[model samples]
Target: MKKKQQEMQQQQELQQQQQQQELQQQQQELRQRDLQQQEKQQRLFFSSSYFISFAAAVRWLPPLAFGEGKNLTAAAAAAAAAAAAAAVAAAAAAAAAAAAGVAACFFLRKEGEG
Candidate 1:
């Protein structure tokens, strides 16, 4: 009877250890997921800020080019065209930057995994 009790106690302890390990593994996975989400958000924020600054520059510079005596209609049209071009360029650049960032992250993750 004593031997049977000892065996049962050992089995219970092993089960408890296994449960603890599983819980730890789950927690680690959750932390890793959170880290990945944070990194993604950071990349998005960086790209968006870059685009916003570039757009602001595009919007602000056309007036300077027109100077103090330029025709209002011509200036407005020029500004519109400049804004359109800048928007396209900024979008492409932002996309490229974001892609590069994500790729770099993937490579770093691979390295860490290995």
Candidate 2:
């Protein structure tokens, strides 16, 4: 009789342990789902904000390009173009000076050798 009672007690303990494990598993799943939902909401908010800013920029882009609105981008582009032109001119001048130096050396060397 004692053996039977001991077996029944063991079975009850096993069932309780299984129930506890199942409850823990469910809680973990719920937590994961909550975290996923929060992440999705954050992503949506970030993209929406970016979209709003992009829309605003596009709204002014055409006017700016056509020179009808603020000349911020246009002025910047003009300045950049001017700087690039100056750089090209300087490079050409340096190249010409280098060629002249090489030619003078060749002529002087030929005169000395001859």
Which candidate leads in lDDT?
Answer: 1
List clashing residue pairs in candidate 1: none
Clash totals for all candidate models: 0, 0
Tens digit of per-residue lDDT, candidate 1, span 1-114: 999999999999999999989987886787688668866965777677557656655665656676745555655665676567656766766686688679767866875686
For model 2, how big is the CA root-mean-square deviation?
28.0
Model 2: worst 10 consecutive residues (lDDT sum):
49-58
- Window of ten residues with lowest summed lDDT in model 1: 68-77
Clash count (model 2, backbone only): 0
Off by over 4 Å in 1: 61-114
| lDDT (Cα atoms) of all candidates against the true structure | 0.71, 0.66
lDDT of 2: 0.66
Per-residue alpha-carbon lDDT of candidate 2 for residues 42-85, written as tens digits (9 for 90 to 100): 56655665565455455556666777756677655655655565
CA RMSD of all predictions: 7.0, 28.0
